[model samples]
Target: MKLLKIAFKSAANRKTGLILASVSIALSIMLLLVVDTIRKQGKSSFVNTISQTDLVVGARSGPLNLLMYSVFRIGNATNNVSWKSYQEIAAFPETDWTVPLSLGDSHKGFRVLGTNQDYFKYYRFAGGKNLAFAKGKQFDDLYDAVLGSEVAKKLSYKLGDKITLAHGLTSTKFAEHGDKPFRVSGILERTGTPVDQTVHVSLQAIEAIHVDWLSGSPSPIKISAEKAREMKLNPKTITAFMLGLKNRTATFRMQRKINQYRAEPLLAILPGSTLAILWNTLGNFEKILVAIAFLVLLSGLLGMLTTLLSTLNERRREMAILRTVGAHAWHIIALFLLEAFMVVLGGCILGLIASYVVQLVAQPLLVQLYGIHIDIMFPDAEQWAIIGGALLLGLFFSLLPGLIAYRRSLQDGLVLKV
Candidate 1:
C-alpha cells in the first residue's frame, strides 16, 4: 500500500509524459476493441442471416453459389425449379414447412421477391427470429405488396404507396411493369440483413404482371391490369426455396434425395455448412484486420516504454530520497512496476468506455450502410484476458528502467546528482 501510494504520487509529479503515454495506449486499445467487436459481430450477423431452416433447395448449382443466390440475393439462378416439383417436395412426409422464392425482378435497385404467406410464417433468420411487420399487415389483395425496411426508407414508401417493379434485376423505367403497379400493404421491421433490401409480393401477383408477356416481351394482345387481376394466377416456376424438416437427422438424406431427384435436377444444401464455406473465403481479410490492430498496439507499448525510460534520469533524485528514508533496492523497482500497472489499467478502463461509445454511434451507420447490426457489450472473458496480458506485459517492460534506477540509486548513495 505504501509503495503504491508513493508510486502514484511520483507519477502525478510527471503527469504530462505519463498521461500522453497512457492516452496512446488507450487509443490503440480502443481501436483493437472496435475492430475485434466488428469482426465478431459482423461474422455473427452474417452467419445468422438465416437460421432454423434445415436446407436451401435450388436448381442444380454449386453449394456456395446456391447459398449466395438463395439467401444473400447475390447473382442469378441458372434455372428455376418447376412448381410441380416444388408442390411434390412440399408434400413430402418429412418436410415440415417450405417457402418458395421467385426472384429476377427489382424496384429502385432492391430485389423483388415473389413469395406466399408461408414465407412470413415459416421463414426464420438471426437464430429463428420471425419476420415481423413494422407497420400494417401482410399482403391480402392481389395487387398488395410488402416493403422491407431499407426499401420503405430509401424510396420513401408508405402503406398504400404505389410501387412498380422492373422486369429484370436491373432497375429501369423502360422495363418497368407500369401497367400493374403494386400497392404497399406492409413494411417489415428492420432486420439488419439482406431482407432489409428486398421487396416482397405474392407469387400470384408476379404471375399476373407477366400474364400477357411472351418470352419476356409484351404480347400484341395486352390484358389490362383489371382483367389480369380477375384471372386466376399460377406461377410456373420459382428460383429457390427454404425447407425445414421435422427431423434434423434427415437433412443429409433429404439433400441426397433432392440431388438425385428424377422429376428435375435439384440441389439441397445445409444452410450452416454452406454459410461456413461462404465466410471462409473472407478468413484472410479478417486476419488482416486483426494484424493491423496489433501493429497499432505494438506502437503504443513502445511509446509507454520510451516514456518510462526517459523519465528515469529525472526520477533519480526521488529514488535517492526514498533510499535516504530506509527504502530497500527492490522497493525502488516495485515503485516503477506499480506505476506502470496503474497506467495500463487506467488506459484499459478508458479504452473500454471509448469503445462502447463508438459502438453506440456505429450501430445505426452499420445497419444503414452495410445492413449489419452490432450490439454494444462489455469485454468478454477473452477480452478480459487480453487486457490483463497487456497490463502484465507493460509491467514486464518497465523492469529495465526500474533496474537502472535501482542500480543508480544504490551506487550514488544519498548524494544528489542533477
Candidate 2:
C-alpha cells in the first residue's frame, strides 16, 4: 500500500509528462479498434445482405462480377439470359423457387428492378428475414411500382404518386418512358442493404414500357401506354435470376448441369462459396491494415519508453531520498511498475471513450456513403485481449528505467548526486 501511494504521488507530481504519454497511446488504441471494427462489420453487413438463396444464375461471366451486378447493383451485365432458359431452369425438378431479375432502368439515379410477385415470396435477407412493407402492398397492376425505402425517402414519394423511369442505368435523362408513368403502390421498410436503393416493378411493366421502342429509343410507330398495357407483356429476356433448391444435397449437381447446358453459356454460383472466395481475394489487404495498426501501437509503446528513460536522470534524487528512508531496491522497482500500470490503464480507458465518440460521429455517414451499417457495441473478448496486451507491453518496457533507478539508488545511498 505504501509503494502504491508513493507511485501515485510521483505520477501526480509529473502529471503533464504522464498525460502526454497516455494521450499518444489512447489515439493509437482508438485507431486500431476502428480499423478492426470497420473491417469485421463491413464484411458481415455485405454477406448478410442476401440470404437463404442456394444459387445465383446469370449469363456466362466471372462469379464476382455477377454477384456484384445482381446483388450490389454496382455493374452492368455482360449478357442477358433468354426467358426460355429461365423457364427451363425454374422447371427443374430440384428447384424449389426462383426470382427473375430484369435490370437496365433507372429513376433519378436509383436502379429499377423488374421482377414478378415471386420476388416477394422467395427473396430473403439478414438471415431468412422476409421483406416487410412500410406503406402499402406489392404491385399487382402493370403500371404500379414499389419503392425501396431510400428511393421513397430521397424522392419524397408516396402511394399513388406517378413516376417515370429512364431507359439506361445512368442519371442522364436523354430517353425516358414518361408517357408510361407508373403509380407507386408500395414502399419497403429499410433493410440497410442494396434493396433500400431500388425501384421495384412487375416484369410485365418492363415489357409494356419497351413494346414501342427499338434500338434504345422510341420508334416512329408508337403505341400509347393504355394500348401497350392491353397487349401481352411477357418478358423475352432477363439480366439474371436467383434459385433456391428443394434438396440442399442436389445444389452442386444442379450447378454443374446449369453451367454445362447445351442451349447457351450460363453460370451458376453458390453464394456462400463465392463470398469465401471474395474474402480470400481481400486477405492481403486486410493483413496490411492490421500491420499498420500494430505499427501505430508500437510507436505509442516506444513513446512511453522514451518518456520513462529520459526522466530517470531527474528521478535519481528521489530514488536516493527513498533509500535514506529505508526503501529497498525491489521497492523502487515495484514503485515504477505501479506507475506504469496506472498510465497504461488510464490510456486504455480513454481510448475506449474516444472510440465510442468516433463511432457515434461516423456511423450515419458510413451508412449513407457505403451502405454498410456498423453494429454499435462495447469491446468484445478479442478487444479486451488487445487492451491487456498493450498494458503488459508498457509494463515490460518500463522495467529498464526501473532497473536503472534501483542500481543508482544502491550506489548513492543517502547522498544527493549533482
Candidate 3:
C-alpha cells in the first residue's frame, strides 16, 4: 500500500505525460473492444438470423449464393423454384413446416417479401423466437401489407395507411406499383436481423401487381387494385423457401431428396452450415480487423513505455532520495511497476465505459443505416482475459524503465553537473 501511494504520487508529478499515456491506452482499448465486440456479435447475429428452420431451399446455386439471396436478401436469385416444385417438397411426410418466399420487390429501399400466413406462423429467428406484431396484425387481404419494425418506424406507417411497392429491389419512381397500393395491416416487432428491413405482403399481391408488368415494363392496360384482387393470383415461382423437418435426423436425407428431385434442379442447404461458409469466407477480413486492433494496442503500450523511459533520466535524483530513506532496489522497481498497473487499470476501465457509450450512441444509427445490431455487452471471460493480458504486457514493458532507474546508484544522483 505504501509503495503504491509513493508510485502514484510520483506519477502525479508527471501528470500530463502519464495522463496522455493513459489516454492512448484507453483509446486503443476502446478500439479493440469496439472491433472485437462487433466481430463476435455480428457473426453471432448473422449465424442466428433465422433459427430452428432446418434448410433453406432454392433454385440450384452455390450454398453461399443461396443463403445470401434467400436469407440475407443480398443478391437476385439465379433462378426461381417453380411453385409446383415447392408444393411437392412441402408435402413431404418429413417436412414439418415451410415458408415460401418471393423476392425482387422493394418499398423505399427495403426488400418486399411475398409470403403467406405461414411466414408469420412458422418463421423463426434468434433461436426459434416467433415473429410477433408490434402494432397490428398480419396481412389479411390481397392488398394488405405488414411492415417490419424498422420500416414502420422509419416510414412512420400506421395500420390502414396505404403504401406502394416498387417492382425491383432498388427504389425508382418509374417502377412503382402506383395503381395497386397496399394498406398497412400490421407492423412486426424488431428481430435485429434482415427481417426488420422487410415489407411483408401476400404472395398473390406480388402476382397481382406484376400482372401488367411484362419484362420490368408496365403494359398499356392498367388494372386498379380492386380489379387485380379479383384475378387468380397464384405465383408461378418463388425465389426460395425455408423448411423445418419433423426430425433432426431427417435433415440430410430430406436435403438430398430436395437436391435430387426429378422435376427441377434445386439446392438445399443447412442454414447453419451455409452461414458458416459465409463467415469462413470472410475469415481473412476478420483476421485483418483483429490484427489492426492489436497493433493499435501495441503502439499505445509503446507510447507508455516511451514516457516511462524518458522520465527515468529526470527521476535519478528521486531514486537516490528513496535509497537514502532505506528503500531497496526492488522497492524502486515496484514503484514503477505500480505506476504501470495504475495507468493500465485506469485505461481499461475507461475503455470499457467508452465502449458502452459508443454502443448506446451508435447502435440505432448502425441498425438504421446498415441493419447491423451491436449488442451492448458486459465484459465476459474473453474481455477479462484481454484486460489481464494488457496488464501483463504493461508490466512487462515497464520493467525496462524500472531496471534503468535501479542501475542509477546514489552516487549518480548526487554527481556534479558537467
Candidate 4:
C-alpha cells in the first residue's frame, strides 16, 4: 500500500515528462494498429472478393495477369478469345455456367465491361451473394447500361442519365467514343470488388458501340450512328470468360482440355489458386510494412528511455529523502517500473481508440475509391499478441532506468549525496 502511494506521488512529480512519453507511445501504437488492420483487411478483401468462383479462362498469360485483369481491372488482356471459344466452352457438359467479358473501353476512367445477363446471375462476391440492384432495373436494350455503386456515386448518375465512353481507359480525349451514348438503367449495390468501379453493359452493346471502329483506335472514316445500326455488329472477340463447373471433379479435365485446345491458345486457371499465387507475389510488400511499423515502435521505446534517463538526475534528492525514510532500493526500482507500466498502458488504450476513429473516417473513401472495406472492430488474436508483445517490450525498456536508480541508491547509502 505504501509503495503504491510512493509510486503515484513520484509519477505525479514528473507528470509533464510522463505525458510526453505516453503521447509518443500512443502515436506509435496508433500507427502499428492501423497498419496491421489495413494489412489484414486488405488480404481479407482480396480473398473474400472471389471465394466462390471456380475457374477463370483467358488468353495465354500468367495466372497473376488473369487475376489482375479480371478481378482488379489493373491491366489489359494480352489477347482475346473468340466468341466461338466462349460458346464451345459454355456448351460443355461439365460447365455449369459462363460469363463472357468484353473489355478495351472506358467511361470517364472507369473500365466498361461487356457481359451477358449471366454475369449478374453467376457473379458472386463477399460470401456468395448474387448481385442486387440498388436502384432501377437491369439493362433491357442495347444502348442501356448499368453502373457500379462507385461509378454512379462518383459521377452522380441517375437512372436516365446518358454517358459517352472515352476511347481508351485513360482520361485523355484522344479517342472518345462519342457517337454512341448509353443511358444508365441501373446502379448495382456495393460489393467491394472491381465490379463497384465498373460499367456493365451487354455484349451486343459493346459490339454496337465499336461497329465502325477497327482494333482499339478509331477508324479514319467515321461511320454514322444510323449506318452502324444497319450493319450487323456482333462481337467476335472477348477479353475473357469465367466458368462454373458442374462437376468439381472435372475441373482438372476441363482445364487440360482448354489449355490444349486445337483451335486457339488458351488457359484455364482455378481462381483460388491464381489468387493465392498473386498474393504470394505481393505478400512481401505487407511484410515490409510490418517491419517498418516495428521500427517505429522501437523508436518510441527509445524516446521513453531518453525521457527517464534525463529526469533521473533531477530526482536524486527526492530519492535520498525516500531512502532516509527507510524505503529500500528495490522499492525505488518498483516505483519507476510502475510509472512506466502506467504510461504504456494508458498509451495503448489511447492508441486503440485512435485507430477506430481513423477507420471510421476513412471507410467511405476506401470503399468508393479503392474498393476496400475497412472493418473497424476490436483487434483479432494476432493483434492481441502484438499488443501483449509490445507491453512486455515496454516493461523491459522501462526497467533500464529502474536498474540505474537501484545501483545509485546502494552506492549513496544513508547519505544525502548528488
User: Which candidate leads in TM-score?
Assistant: 3
Candidate 1: lDDT of 253? 93
**lDDT (10s digit) by residue, model 4, range 51-140:** 567888999988888877887777889999998988998898999988999888898878999998988888998778899999988889
Q: Across residues 295-378, which tens digit of lDDT does each residue of candidate 1 receive?
A: 777777778789889987777778888888999888998998998888888888888888899999998777655557888887
User: lDDT value for candidate 1?
Assistant: 0.87
- Candidate 4: worst-modelled 10 consecutive residues by lDDT: 409-418
Candidate 1: regions farther than 4 A off: 1-20, 43-47, 91-96, 149-157, 166-179, 189-193, 209-224, 230-233, 246-249, 262-264, 279-288, 314-318, 325-331, 365-371, 413-418
- Residues 282-346 of candidate 2: C-alpha lDDT, one tens digit per residue: 76788888888788878877887887888887788899999888888788888888988898888
Whole-model lDDT, model 4? 0.83
Better of 2 and 4 by lDDT: 2
User: In terms of TM-score, how similar is model 3 to the real structure?
Assistant: 0.90
lDDT of each: 0.87, 0.88, 0.88, 0.83
Clashing pairs in 3: none
Cα lDDT tens digits for candidate 3, 2-70: 887899899999988888888888887887787778788888778768888899999998998898878
Runs in model 2 deviating more than 4 A are: 1-20, 150-164, 175-180, 210-227, 326-331, 361-371, 412-418
Whole-structure CA lDDT of model 3: 0.88
